[model samples]
Target chain A: MAKNKRDGTFYINPYLGGVLLGLVLFGTYYITGRGLGASGAVKSSVVSAVHTIAPVHAEGNKYYSKFLSDDASPMSNWLVFEVIGVIVGGFLSGTLYGRLKFIVEHSPKITGRTRLIAALAGGILFGVGSQFARGCTSGAALSGMAVLSASGIITMMAIFGSAYLFSWIFKKLWI
Target chain B: MVGPLIPMGVIPETWNNVIALLLGVGFGFSLEASGFSSSRKIMGTFFGYDFVVLRVFFTAAITAMTGIFYFDYMGWMDASMLYINPYYVMSAIIGGIIMGFGFALGGFCPGTSFTGVAIGKIDAMFFSGGLFIGVFIFSELYPLFQGLYNSHNLGGAKIYELLGMRDTVFAFLLIVVAVGMFYGAAFVEKKVTKVEY
Candidate 1:
């Protein structure tokens, strides 16, 4: 493996990384009959939290009730387990690359508070959109693209297209 | 002999979780190694300073699509059984636009944020924390959005079918487009000013 000038900055080629990701995605479908997902786990977590706080409320809500069942906990969902794997996988990558370090990352022009605020707002929009679209960027856009799903392609275009437009609007936040 | 191992029974249900873990590992590794752990690098796709996201994303999409199609042709997997995402046009477009807003503002999406969190990025942690809150909000307000959410349900619709073309033809065209974008990205990368994270 080639090393970068800075420690823990080494990375594989983008094309190679893409091929590897493709295989992982292919493997996922082959074994689980599904593609990869990240946000769905977060949704599960949210559902579980609501269920714990107000079982009645959770059951009353059509969306929450749909996911709620006596046979298994919401936390025991496939996406939940997969997310756990993501954490472990990410940890392993960080450990191997020696990149594990606790810190806040932001543009030089912005304060940590500003970044955090943006992050929170972004999460909220993403959360709402994922529900509306039936998945997040990973679950909807990427996975959808793999299977040539119209929703996936449209969602992918919308997200990236909107981001490109908004990025210019919020250029100060990043650049 | 193509697609969706579950319907064909080529892959047992029992091993699903284990496979998830292994795939997750690869997913994480590729993401982190591609510098996705850094917010600036990811944001660079919009700035034109770096096209890593564009390069990696389209490459992965085309690669997987082609691989699956090829395997189907080789009599390896049953493509007919493969699961395609259901199309809900209005919901998809609206949801995507909203999610894009989040991407530009949040500097991290669910998947990349996990990679960042793995590297001990506090911002990533907060972004994920926000996801929990956001999802909670959605679930709580489900009644208000239920109509839109379930408004349109096209079951596992394929893009090619909708476009009035064969799947192979669409896939082939996509490959050409992706290759063109790859070259375009390289050219843009060279022209844009480099931003240090």
Candidate 2:
């Protein structure tokens, strides 16, 4: 099992990685009755930040108030903790593969600035879209599909289908 | 005892966050180890240069679905107890289309962006920041989008039921389709010229 290639970096085979990921997702459902998530944590952080900066305003808002509680901080949620674990796990993997470098990855044709701007724009769109759809790729799509949920399957197709269509429009950014 | 330990009370509520942390670690490790930390690598799926995203994604979906079926069949878990995102016809499709546009432009999704941040990718940091701003925007403008967001709710509908098929039958067909796509992806990858980031 060649761990490292000649370039001082290594990656697991995709299929094997998929199996491991599948088992992890299965464990999540077995134990927590919920699927994995990433954007939810960011939503939590946003709620917490708003609560801290404007307690009254946050409490008054419809969305923020839905997550607010008298006994617990908004940040003290399961998704937040899971995201922290994601960071730790990612760091560990990076260390193992010798890829823990501070660099901006982009296509050679695009400037780092261009990539950053696009990334930011994309993130904003994803954040808004996730809220509307009730979950992102991990939460609504992957998790939903695991249980054969209609919304999950539909959302998954929409995301992939739209991406395939838009990728051509944004071809200059990648290829 | 039926599985989904938390709901079944097999695992106490206090351990929920702890379990979450452990599961997240596995999720994160698998993603980063499979080159998901690189946005370009992920975008490869869209361009047909690399099919890793499709391969890993479909494989994991099938594996988890299969596990759920097996567990339920063996009486180890109650499939009915699992949480399902409710179906909102318009919102789901509209939101997904927007996300797809974002994905191509940003080259990273929420989960993958976190992996990028962990590996110290500056673009990922900006992308995460963008997420916070986007959420804030949505929260502030909730009233304007409230109707669209709340309309056409189907309430946790299952795909098999919607299609008037058995769960086992649906699962079997999904697996067959996934395997066929896997082969097709391999063929496409061979034809497309590899693009290095």
TM-score of chain B of 1: 0.95
lDDT against true structure, model 2: 0.88
User: How do the residues A102-168 of candidate 2 rate in per-residue lDDT, one tens digit apiece?
Assistant: 8988888889999999999999999998888888999889999999999999999999999999989
What is candidate 2's lDDT per residue for B1-197, written digit by digit as tens?
A: 67988889998888877887898889999999898888888989999998889988999999999999999999999989998889999999988998898898888889988988998999888888888888899898888888999999999999999999998999999999999999999999999987876
Candidate 1: where is the Cα deviation over 4 Å? A1-6, A70-76, B1-3
B46-136: candidate 1 lDDT, tens digit per residue = 9999788888888888888887888778888776766677888788898999899999998788888888888898888888888888888
What's the distance in Å from true for residue B161, model 2? Answer: 1.4
Q: For every model in order, what is the number of clashing pairs?
A: 7, 0
| lDDT (C-alpha) at residue B157 in model 1 | 85
**Best candidate per DockQ, number?**
2
Clashes in model 1: which pairs? B1-B77, B2-B77, B2-B78, B2-B79, B3-B77, B3-B78, B3-B79
